[model samples]
Target: MFGKSLKVFGILLLCISFTGCAKARYAAPEPETRVVGGASRAEAFRFTPSGDQAWLSWEQKPTDEEYGSFILKIGRANFADGSPLPLDTAVGVEVVLWMPAMGHGSNPVALEKIDIGTYRVSEVFFTMPGDWEIRVRRTTEAYGVEETALAIRI
Candidate 1:
């Protein structure tokens, strides 16, 4: 009986140590930000049967004065309300397509100078019917970052 009790206690201590180690490994880190901005100017879009599209546009200001150039990073998520949902928790959330204007493009088609002020952007399209979220992350020349979120249903 004494030997059996000692073995059980040893097993319990090993399990507790392993649990602590696993918790440390599975911890999530916080996000890091360089320069902060007021809000991002983003637009959401959806297509009609005749190939027509809709857009929800907004205006934004630079986070810092050193912002010389800017590029928009767009991503899509599926939610009814435009709330920040975890990517892993959300269902049907996928990046349909993304376009980076200026230096934003991974494979830039062409470079064009955007007028420094409020401007109208091109219409984004949704291929099929579902909930979608469009997020835009703008990076400036001075390393300033700004982001905005928009939700859409098709």
Candidate 2:
């Protein structure tokens, strides 16, 4: 009985030792952005055939001018790779309706941020219905300012 109890105690000590030495598991870090051609895009655009809704995600950075400090580890969901963007980052979106053939642009449409990395612009109906272009301007400190124009025939 004494020998059996000693063996059990030793096994318990061995298990405890192993548990203490186990390493913690953490999520892998994200990858860095690579620029190709003249422009590097940290944003993604998705337009549906319904012609009523659009989704955009762009990277933004705000720096402290006096201190010259940047918020570190701020992550924006790479719409291209399906990652999560930081919550505190500021992003501004604008929508402009342009008639390329007519050489005129329409009134500004309001954009709302639905989540951390998604913006929704609704009720984008063209008045004349020809070759209408939607120019989306995304402004952020990280990427400065970038504009994308999408053409649709209604």
Which has the greatest lDDT?
2
Alpha-carbon deviation at 104 in model 1, angstroms:
18
Clash-forming residue pairs, model 2: 75-86, 76-85, 77-85
lDDT of each: 0.34, 0.47
Displacement of the residue 90 alpha carbon in candidate 2, Å = 5.1
Which runs of model 1 end up more than 4 angstroms from their true locations? 1-55, 58-115, 141-143
Task: For candidate 1, report its TM-score.
Answer: 0.27
Per-residue lDDT over 31-135 for candidate 2, one digit per residue giving the tens place of the 0 to 100 score: 222221223233333322211223332232211221111111123344686554444333665678687889998555545655554555543445654666667
User: Model 1: how far is 48 from its true place, Å?
Assistant: 32
28: Cα error in model 1, Å: 14
